[model samples]
Target: MDEVAAAIADPVRRHILTMLRDESLSAGDIATRFAISRPAVSRHLRVLRESGLVRDELVGRKRIYRLDPGPLAPLAEWLAGLAGGDRWERRLDALETEIYRTRRERRARGPVEHRREHTA
Candidate 1:
């Protein structure tokens, strides 16, 4: 999971994954889409491959890459858990504010003092 997270952390690798999402592309095809050198794109592909986010096939003299998306399942679930926890945290925060407001209002209104009549 750590490897998959780290792999997707880079913008280049994310873009590569997006590119491969639709269709498999040869290494040269992917490299051409970026302004970086072919070796740099190759390195990004290597990271994705090592993280199991992508699969590569050797066809003739070219290596074609495609998205695997299997390793992303755990990461997606973990993120969903965080989102749920965040919603609960927001609710708790609102409840705390309401409790404090109610206490302050009660304190302000508590025990009205009686006025003494002065008969002179």
Candidate 2:
């Protein structure tokens, strides 16, 4: 899927799209959720917006972002051509959720030590 390949080229943008799919979020909100700077987050948002996976509108002074599934329709249909696209999607979704949750848990602990103290 060329769209999938294009959409997944940048990890940050992919994460931003995933987050927006779950719920509409402002630029600042997305920046807060990511470890990167606000400008970096904005750049990722720009990519998502350009890719047609997300749309944003100015709500007063704030820009609210939402997932635009219309563009992803083709990608979905292409994926459906596979033997188990639906099942594969479900499994991938579960894995992604688990990974995100685990990362949040560990990040909450502050600068993670590469080496854990173990008693021999």
Candidate 3:
């Protein structure tokens, strides 16, 4: 998971992944999409391949790159867990309701009456 996160941390690599999401592309095809040199894009692809976010196959003379998506499962599960429940929100709402009720009760009681002592 750490390797996957590190691989996806780059905006350029993320964009590369987006490009490969629907279709596979050759290394040259991916390089053409960016302003960077082919070597730079190749380095990014290497990192992605090592991290398991992408897979490449040799087709004829060209190597085609495609999104694997399997390594991202752990990241997706973790994110889903974070967004899974409203229990925290419900607890906060209950606390807020209790605070408001206490304030309302105090206000309804008005001011406190004081006993005055009479001295001879």
Candidate 4:
């Protein structure tokens, strides 16, 4: 999971994953989409492969890469846990209630008292 997160932390690698999500692409095809060198793209692919986010198959002389998506399950679950159950809505409702309570208390206090200070 750490490796998956690390691999996904790179913008280039994330883009690569998106590229491979719908369909597999040859290494050369993937490299051509980026301005970087083939070797550099290959290195990114290697990191993704090691992270289990991607899988590669050699088709004839070309290597085809595709998104694995299996390793991402843990990350997705962790994110969902972070989101909690209706956490945002509950927090907002609590805040609104507090605001209304404060307003009601202020209203119950009636008018503010003003005291004049005498010069020493």
Report every candidate's CA lDDT. Answer: 0.92, 0.81, 0.92, 0.91
Model 3: clashing residue pairs?
Answer: none
lDDT of 1 by residue, 1-120 (tens): 999999999999999999999999999999999999999998999999999999999999999999999999999999989779878989999999999998787677664421121231
Question: Which residue runs of candidate 3 sit more than 4 Å off their true CA positions?
Answer: 85-120
Q: Write the per-residue lDDT of candidate 4 for residues 2-39, one digit (tens) a residue.
A: 88999999999999999998899999999999999999
Question: How would you encode candidate 2's per-residue C-alpha lDDT over 60-112 as one tens digit per residue?
Answer: 89999998878777777876776687888999999999999988977776554
Q: How many steric clashes does model 1 contain?
A: 0
Candidate 3 residue-wise lDDT, 1-120, digit = tens:
999999999999999999999899999999999999999999999999999999999999999999999999999888768896576778999999999998787677664511121231
Candidate 4 at 71: error in angstroms?
A: 0.2
Error of 2 at 44 (Å): 0.8
lDDT at 102 for candidate 3?
A: 82
Question: Backbone clashes in each candidate structure, one number apiece?
Answer: 0, 0, 0, 0
Candidate 1: pairs in clash: none
**lDDT score at residue 63, model 2, on the 0-100 scale:** 95
